[model samples]
Target: MDKSVDLQHYYLELSPEPVRFDAVSQLTNVFFDDAKQQVFAVRSGGATGIVVKSATDGQNISFCMEDRGTIRSIKFSADNQVLAVQRNDTSVEFVPFNANNQPNVPEMLTHQGKNIIYGFVWVQERQVALISKAGVEIFQLNFEKRTLKSVKSLNITVNWFSFCPTSNFALLSSNMGTILTPVILKASTITKLPRLELGTSQGCSGRDVTLAQLYGTNAIMILRQLQNRQFEVVIYLLNGPGLAPKKSHILRLGQSGRFAMNIVDDVVVVHHQASATSMLFDIALGGAETEVGSGAVIHQPIIPAKTIKPYTLEVPSMSLDGKTINCDLYSQHWVLFQPNIVIDAKLGCLWHVLLKLNSLCALITDRFRLVEFLLQRTEGKPVLLNVLKEMMSVNYSGTMLPVIESIFNKLNCLYKSVLDNELQSQMALMALSTKSQSSKLSPVPRVIVDQSDAYTGVFSSITDTEQLGKILLLYLHSLARNGITANPELSKQIVIDLVRNKQFDTLHQLLKYSALNESKPLACFLLSLSNSDPSISQMALDMLARLNANEIILEVLLEKGQVVEALRIAKQMPGADSLPARKYLEAAYKTKDPLVFHSVYNFFQAKNVRLRGSPDFLKHEQCTEYVQYYQTLISTQCL
Candidate 1:
């Protein structure tokens, strides 16, 4: 059963371009430019054919160059018009390309360095950076002037570095990758953030540190060996300026030999070469040991560590056409880039890692945590709805009730947060548009699971009204805590169920506290339940009373033969004399109680006198018929 769940939950899908290898140079000539999502094959320093291809967009750009010793780092401008090549320690060579593959005059751009240039990357269309033992230097290339101008440079001793193109962010490591400095590299500006010093317990190696965006925040995921000698991926989120970057998570890869990582759908997927399997962790899980200031450490994988989904690669075959063959799931030569890009230069293939959320539904036994994790995904709502619907479809036995309750709590918690934030944002925007003293801008809000979404999608189809009533009440009680309006149809069902179970006091308190959605139709529904328990009618009457819906209140009172109560309410209205109290008198007449009939008559008679100074009915007044009935009742009683 576990294997069945693992079969489809996570895997790697092939990107468009899998075969970008040069048969002549094989794996030896190729290098990946992650910033452009392109792979380049430099044949003999480009004296032979040079080729560039992208797995992302099927982009291919090729040019030739006279042998420039060994190309260390290479990248092309955004427009593919200028190529920056690093062949030596002192400087980077910028060669402009005109039209298709023709070279212009090459320009040498050197950086201020006590040390040589280690590697470089193109920050923007014409901006590039050179990192060395000394520091990082960002420079701009002016094609028109044929010059390389210095932009901004940071002076700090660096051992190695990693870059995330998504935010134009970089992490420079020194003191053996334990001391880290974060900086934002823009086309014209470099915002260097505060330096972070890793604790001594964590390893001091520089090779294992990688920078990437996880959950939309630029963070460093370092594969470190702890003091206990166990390997863990220690992640530190680099927050905005003035806020110190903090260590947020620790993903334990027990007995790790060599592990690589990728962030997919905000989940951290760690691939271990020795085990030939991958383990996934969602920090949102808030692991058992989420101790404050110690960073949350996830002791176990979400699902047992499993190999990547099986895939077939196409290669030349003995048949007339190429045939697909099973590819190794976790190859030693496989290279992983941030946010789900994987490449195996030796196999001449690139496969993108993906998480199949639909299959994940089964492996996540803790339903509440499943929902909380899904709430953060881009394509999660429909999946969440489907999962919730399945949970609702179960027989709703007592054992599963706690699990369902937990799921509801998670959904409502997220819903209330999203709703409150959106309302605040809207209010702020309105204030800003008018330029009022209250002008303020709220943080943008994100969508999440809400109450109505659950009802309409999951609970509405419930056939067992009894079970549904209990479940609905549970969900509604959770929603009530969040201050969200409960669904009326659901409220009606709950009231009926409560009445059936003889939970009148609970029902009364819920109505009195306004826990259920209050509406005239709901009040009437409660009136129907009065046959089971008379107090239920009073519940309905009280609900109407709170609304000041005197008309409906009078109908309910008279219908129940509570003539005196009905008359009292009619008298309390603003236009008490104009109130039509004839129904109250008629109801009293029907009761055959002469005293009740006579009291009702006197009240109307007094009202008539106050309105027109006549005890008898006026031409416009409609009380003559009631008066006759009252007199008949009195005579009948005397006889």
Candidate 2:
């Protein structure tokens, strides 16, 4: 069943409909605010009007703007109360709106110094950051006064700046996009992070440097086009205490062309313009080790390049004349944004690429890597659980053994990690009264599939109980191999199946290695099976002996007419004097064996001499009745 890929490998697809706008006008400018997920279109330099559309809300808000002199940079403040429009090299005009959202008289604010403004971003609801050639300046917007107040400023030569709203950090690149500094602008504060220096032969352009959070790590990704026209994305991690950016991974993109990146569910999706396909890469998957001395592991795409599933644009636009149209994806005017947004400015269409998670299962050939990759995904557990069911439904084969082993091991490792984290958390809580003593608060990609989940989802659903039990043995073995304990119920089920199949050797090993849990009920159940298999019963008895269950042991022995063994066990046990000595004699008398009767009487007589200073049954001993019964039995034997 492994490597059963879909015919088209349709792992990714476009949304059913592309977001439509007035794209017919080539004179209009389209800009996307990564912070708010809003797309803005200013027609003929805002002479027609400004149209703002939110991808999430699907609502459009349009406001008229008087002719602005060649608007260079424009965006709404975080609260949409003020419209920030940059027209010149160093000044931005802030226009506040009234209760009716009509633009008021604009207030102009220039840069801190003469440095030309490269870009600007809305850092907060009322704060905006201006990135310039020399540094960044953060300003607080005073919507009531229709003015701007300078809050914080930093001076460092910068070539470009990239911000990731998810991580709330911005990257500043200088020295031709090689030396990068990171900053966190949030809650009206600017906090500087460590600076990283890239030693690539040639620095990347501003459009090539991207900042994003991949699977809980703040990552700086640089897309470099090789001499052969091939491209690779170098990832540097901005985690760990006071540590410099570490080049931990490099995605080996074999194809060459214009490339754009989108991190979907921690999986990096690289879209190639020329091929019109996206290749998936997961950092969690193992790949070739080390390309540069930096020791960055080189990774290949998770699957082959597959085109986005075709989509039909349903929105009727002025250009389309009220008709549904099939649009060209990956078009010449298509602009890719961080995370997963894609837009074609000329068409005035926007779409968020979606991953077909179930389709991914079929595309991946290696089961181990599939599990490894899926285990880290946010919605992977359910998919993985389904995969197990599929595997179960398939016919067993020798080739499937290793595949099952790999999956089981991966699941166990993930479970182990979860258990370890929980234990550490508990210990940390113990060290403090109200707070944990731990400091690392980073995200780790893990699938939380435990043995019980697998059993319930896959194993127990099997109608063939016999085969299910066999598979359960293999499953339990895997857990045991990983130093994990199984539920007692699961242990009992497997043992029942083994016994029913008469697999004594394997059953013995299960008992020997202590894979099965020991309990009085299990021991009694095993003892019941003595008639069928004496060895299994002995195994049960041994287990009980190990558990020191003297009462059950004595009961079993007396019931079997092993009066000597039962009495001996009772005598060796603590509080033997309190044990009913007369009971053993009575049980031996019921046996009607002369020798057994003699031995039972002698066993009690020895106890009486040791405790009462004479070898005679005392009145309170309560064995005189059994002694008389034994004499009568001996007399009958003589007759």
Candidate 3:
């Protein structure tokens, strides 16, 4: 009846001799050279180069020039036969891997002005697109004819750069501080497509701009700005023509520590963290505002041992179809070393099931067949069932029915057996009571000791209340569809017992039933019950907020309007004070209601005190000024 599944899988883990390189700050790039059967790494801060043989072999290679400064960028040629290395302070080198499978002496490529190449991509075996402080430059190589050409140079400051996979179009970040410009390229001709001006340039760190394609047509950029000494993500979408560039939408990710965005087909996978655990959001560029998939941190090796083990092995993976996402626990083996197989079909099947489960109705028959196929082929290998349960909960109408029914049937049978045992024990007690009354020469009382009382006594004998609650949960869930409302008081008592015992699963079922009914008393009771549990309080608040419970919230706030209390609840509920604040302010301005004005002014003062006049807060002066002036007026009146 708990209906929760354990989602754990084995991932490759490697315990290497913690190799540290001065130049190897982080693994910035990874590319497989099929022709050479090798993998190359570009170390960001140091001039050294590290290369490892493909997972097929376990050989390590390092290349460095004592005088080459730091490696700014490195890219592999399309044919995987050549490596292009760009160094800090505007220098380029070409290292060719020879017949011995080792990098040969570096060949100088550029002899130009100080061109700080920030990023580059190998367009073809010959041509490479590079971004510098000056502008954009295209370099070409001709192996057959032995020719190199500078095809074109665009004179515009580019802060960030990325090329379309299938097109000549290159996305350039407008050096107008933080604004972005998309440019269409046709061989030698460069046309600026359009620019979308997002937020003001203030506090925008140009270094944080990351570019990726969103749903093919749109260009997505994630911008970071310093807020309260922390970094937050500001997502921007740019599409359409140069004159009328459409700003699709903007989202403010609260308290995101570090973030990474990668586009796969129509979906964008956003990896971010607010606290200890990393959160993954599978965002559909073409669909609704809500994310398609959500997952939490499962494993992180980078965290220190002193800190809580924030990393779990569950890495959430999104399918290319944009329908399903799964969280998988990778073996420490796979995490450190490359996997032997190209793909884990079992993991693939689980991911497919998660995506299909997103659409419950469509997945019912189709998903069942797919699951059957996986079970047959896999032969009962444990899959990531946690992700499967989350998906099933969302789309639980058609396809979920059979799965839920199967689980429910087993639980129901178990509960019925337990109930039968309870019934027999109660009968035995009544028979004993009858015999004792006759033997003692006492009149037998008409009142009977029922099974509920006997069951309570049996549960009281158990040492662990937690186990007892779990048993009761299964029993309660088995009765969910049997019209428990026929005995509302009994149902209410059962819910209270579960709540008191911290049996959340049963409480959730009861809340679900309460929400389904249209009765006000039931709704209020459910809301109160939800309010009692912190886990369900947000759900209750959202439901009540939808019901336009502004009056109710305001009334409660007036009695408990301590600054801390007001701020705590207000922060949780966006636009919490908007309605009440405006109403009170209007009453004060129009009717000269001192009490109303004082309350409105105090709310504004509370916010000002909390925010402490930050610059970002100052930018929205109209809203801030109105509240400040009203508060000042109240201070004058009180004086």
How many clashes show up per model? 1, 0, 22
What's the best-to-worst order under lDDT? 2, 1, 3
Can you write out model 1's per-residue Cα lDDT over 482-563, one digit (the tens) per residue? 7778878767766765776676766776777687899999998888878998788888888988877788998888887888
Roughly what TM-score does model 1 have, to 2 decimal places?
0.80
Residue pairs with clashing backbones, model 2? none
Error of 2 at 382 (Å): 2.3
Error of 1 at 170 (Å): 2.2
Per-residue CA lDDT of model 3 for 1-639, tens digit only, reads 121211111111112212221222243444333223345555434454465434334455555434355555555565545667666556666656656545555443552447677666565666766667777777776544444577877777776565554444566666455566666655444677666565565424444554544434544455564546544444444545555354443333445455443333222333343332222222221223432232211121111111111122233368654443332323111111111112122232111011112222222333433233222222221221222333344333454545544443433343344555566667667788464532222222112222243234332333234343343443344445432222344445555566666777655654554422323344355557765676655444444555666445443444333333444456566675343444344434453545555565566556656657532233433445446656677678852
lDDT (10s digit) by residue, model 2, range 1-639: 233354336788777666777774657777788878888887775364878898877877888878867677778776677777888887777777777777775454444447788778887777888888878778887755755777898888987788898878888888887688888776567778888887566677778887888877899999987788888998999886477788899998998878888888788989888988888988877777777688888998877888887666666468846666667867878887768888888778788888787888877777777778778777788888887777766455555766887788778877776776777777777777755455553244366887678866776565343344345556777787777877777666656756776767767877886667678888888887777677987898889989999889898888888888888788788898776777887888788877888887877778778887887776876776776776786678842
Residue pairs clashing, model 1: 89-117
Rank order (by TM-score, best first): 2, 1, 3
Of candidates 3 and 2, the better by lDDT:
2
Error of 2 at 572 (Å): 3.3
